[model samples]
Target chain A: MPNSETMAGTSAAHSEAMIGLYDVHKSFGPLEVLKGISFEVPRGGVVALIGPSGSGKSTILRCVNLLETPNAGTIKVGAQTLAFSKRHRLPGDRRLADFRARTGMVFQSFNLFPHKSVIENVMAGPLIVKRMARDEARAIAERLLARVGLAEKAEAAPARLSGGQRQRVAIARAMAMEPDVMLFDEPTSALDPELVAEVLAVIRGLADDNMTMLLATHEMAFARDVADRVVFMRDGVVVEDGPARQVIETPQHPATQAFLAHFHRR
Target chain B: MSGVSYHWDFSFLWGYRTVLLTGLAYTMAYTVGTILLGLVIGLVAGLMRMSRNPFIRGPAFAYIEIFRCTPLLVQIVWFYYAFPILIGIEMSATTAAVLVLSLYTGSFYAEIFRGGILSLELGQWDAARAVGMRQGQLMRHIILPQAVRRMMPPFINQSVIQLKNTSLVSTIAVTDLLYQGMLITAATYRPLEVYTLIAAIYFVVLFPLTALGQYVENRLRYAE
Candidate 1:
């Protein structure tokens, strides 16, 4: 039998061609944040990326949405080839915005539009960017809020909500766009310890439905429970990639082992 | 001699009522006109200051800085005298008052607009951009509403001050509430009574506007 790690990596990568990054390099001034990173996020599957702070995991996720343009190499999301240095187009290119409309990103800070009520926040992307009708946007926002268990708080401003509720509302807002891919950047990290599970539960439900997801999370149980594969990063490089079972159970890289040991001990 | 039949002379208010009323009308007109014009200019200048290009932001910065550093009275006098000299527009004194008032308020409004935009969290911009909102769309849908909502109180305060500032127009021979009060009191020699009556009229006008400001603030309190 093939090694479980290799099989897991290959199986996870080959599941679908939803997103691919080829030798992506990103630098801010003199500091290189991402050094030739490569990965494939399969459609309708969940992949959890874990690393220390500043390991470039979030930067990679941002590049997928063209939020941060990689200095070198290319990123392909769905059928769109995102901006790269070779193309000489910044991430704010028209196509990048179009591509962003097709992808939903849940921020760590839950930056819900403060001026809008919860349902209005959810409806904003659909109505403003997509030019959808108001009544239709309202209905769709209601449905997404229901999915996230926040239907009751629809008319309330995000400030009236708890951190967890606001994060769920943020997720619903992103989902209301009916995006093809959803990127979660430490969705639960901003919540209180008790609140984290509720947000994670909503994400776990998304995983069960086979929603295309690329999650950057710190919760080990979340990785083991929901992610199809777990990619470990250290020092701006992917140190290990394998099925969640093996990666969590038996990491091969000395760096992964040391990282996990330091992490879990705390 | 001590009893000089001193009573609150209520007749000056009615006798000079038309003049005071006309002055109040001029004050209201100038206040509203300046507020609207200033808000529009401030919005544009504030956005230019926040823009990426140094060419754009630099001039906007200079505009805001120069106006904010200079006194409103100086600006008003300059607009009234120097601007007309520069442009060769022979306008009336009252017209000059309105024009100068708008430019003065425009400077303060620019500061208010810039401060409101800067107060927002940095993450909000990132999220707005991530959602594919163009700069214009983001301002319309996300940024401006929040900024305008946050800015209501200060704007209202400016209006109250603006109403009081209209008294300064008397310096340039434009008859306003204070000037009208002065003309009547000087002629009639009822300084205490006339001034007291003037204070009462100011109360009547400004109290309602301050109340409106408080109401709007209370209504939008949930924005926090």
Candidate 2:
């Protein structure tokens, strides 16, 4: 019934959806992580994946950008599509790289290039991957840094920045790629409580600006406030999929209700 | 107990300074040449060692192990005296010295390069790949720049050892600083002064290099 409902939802917004994952299956050795995962993010739509730690939320986000190739499924982002199955060979590195270029991903740990300065980290994708002119890259980097409210720290090293500042810079770095979609894998999980707001504010700003994003987060309150749709995952499968408010407030599935209960109890 | 007191003099060495200088120049030349060649070999071999294919990885592993386990002195001698017989080709002492030293230094450098790269967190690679950079670009732009800072102290330390290892070439009559000292001892009958000056010259050259390594290490540490 969920699959049919997903199909019905897909066709209703097929023209707008920027990301699609169908029957995605993933495994690590003998341990299966994602079993028949399916979801779609319409353009400018914010979809938050919520679940406990081992619930395959992060795996789903990673698969969206081909960071962890699925054992079986089809993943589509923008104009690129990757189909993975036993019979079909995986795409070559060049093709995969080009496909990945279309999407941006922010990690739990802000994996900024510590060796590069803040602006350089922002400019890295455009300068090295896109082969943009130095002046052009600098201008883009400066603009993105300003947008993220870290323009003053452009010349500073990543080590010099606070956790929140680094995460903001990471957002700017990913934004510089001009990705069709952005994937945030617990972007604020590594930050202190005080630091989490600044990063969440930046992400909220992105959502306000209509950036299509798939966020895997434990921040239930933020997810309800910012995400347009919520996909509740448990044990590698989506147990409930509905509007952000409905799923968080009145989850239909017992699994989802139990998961949200822990968050509300806190 | 009665003991014979030997006269100590270094003034004699001042006259033969040019010979010692030329010998010093040769030592430096070999060191620079072999180090460059060894670095190239190390890079290639290090990369090969990381390759998923056992065919590529196996040879690199064998090469690193062979040179690392055996003595550098024996390698130099075997290349100079015994290798030519096996290959059936005439080999010069200079050629043999350079080849053996480069291979020896390369084996160690390969490990340093590989270890430095491997020490980086997997997240760094993920970040680079996420931005759509290929393997080569990630290694060149993102990985190497950081890894090189970690690699500096060990790299310089290895190069310092390579410089000292050059002394082994003297056994094959290569006119390095040590060989020059031996020749000077023969003619002047001043083994003490001649050998002592040779050791002093090596100290002078190497002390600065070691100091430079520490300076770079401290700078990189503060940079982070």
Candidate 3:
């Protein structure tokens, strides 16, 4: 048997999958949302999950962050791994929190805290969750807000900004945590057509910086442009997975072909 | 055809001003005290009602319902008489009055708070949790700030109502505004003048607060 030191060294060395989901299963009452789904996102890789509405695309992203607990699976992010079964008990609140702190999630509604000024919203997670010092967090927040092109709007309230600006602030807020992996669940789906471009630009910037990301999005063009790999899912299962060019362009599976055809027609 | 009248004397009010003002001070103390205590109770009870644990949620739900359903006067009088017997600790009439009144006001405030919290979109909760905020941090930093803003107008309105409810404490001999006014009326045999003055004082205090509540409600009416 390998010693504890060797095991730790092995996991540290070979943990290329920054985020992984193995046979994740989820159900709400009688309806199964995710059925034995599996995926792995390597370090600094960009994976876009594209699928129809009920295909459990968002559920997979949420499960990676443990927002939704799966009935059966093993989720690995960096060195932290959680194994789930029918009666799986969560390890501890502290461990789960530490796991979550290493992964950042962006939502569809761009949920910037309405009561906070834009800069404070960006600084909140680091200051509150990570317990960072105020000046350091504020400096990081200022730089991030600048990176997202909202430096001038730091003191403004969320109500004063456009939907795209709010989403960008949300991205900056998530980036403040400096996570090992980022999850985007329909980030641009709620924005106006013109506004979507601004938000997508910031996301593309993250990809340029080699941020490991998992995006569940409808923007096929943006997905193709930014993603290293693309996974096509339908009815709680992955229908196709390959290079972004082949999956979006060639689409060998009939389901993939149909899904892409619908997108093309639109 | 004769309206019962002794010629009304506005002159006596000047002499009685200190008495009336002293009573006003007591009323103010009671009002502020009840508001602080009531708000603390309402916040705890409101959060307890939201708890998933049956043990906590059930008691919180029952407390809100019981106090809200009973009359404030009855609750106060019951506490004044029964509390010493039940708890084996005699409380002053003023103490009993304040305790019962704060509790009564708290039930309504709890409902107001609960409604404010529920009114927020579930998305806010999700977004906060997604960012690695623990449940306590999320409620404190995200949910409560927004909910408290929404709870403000109603909370102020409840304060006004509780101020008026303090009039009930006169029955327990607390010598509040109403009680002092009653004493002056008996001493001078001028009921209309003294009672009218008392009514006007209540109006003076409460009208501004009600108006402030309206202003806050208007300001908070944002596109949620």
TM-score of each: 0.87, 0.95, 0.93
Of candidate 3 chain B, the 10-residue stretch with the lowest lDDT total is B1-10
How does residue A84 of candidate 1 score in lDDT?
A: 73
The order of the candidates by TM-score, greatest first, is 2, 3, 1
Q: Going through the candidates in order, what is chain B's TM-score?
A: 0.86, 0.96, 0.96
Question: How much is A128 displaced in model 3, in angstroms?
Answer: 1.5
Predictions in order: lDDT: 0.82, 0.92, 0.88
Evaluated against the true structure, the overall lDDT of model 2 is 0.92
Off by over 4 Å in 3: A1-14, A91-93, B2-6, B222-224
Lowest summed lDDT across 10 adjacent residues in model 1 chain A is found at A1-10
lDDT of 3 by residue, A181-215 (tens): 89999999999999999999999999999899999
- Stretches off by above 4 angstroms in model 1 are A1-16, A86-96, A263-266, B1-10, B182-196, B211-223
Residues B40-124, candidate 2: write the lDDT tens digits: 9998899899999899999999999999999999999899989999999999999999999999999999999999999999999
Score residue A86 of candidate 1 by CA lDDT. 61
List each candidate's DockQ score: 0.44, 0.79, 0.62
Error of 3 at A113 (Å): 1.5
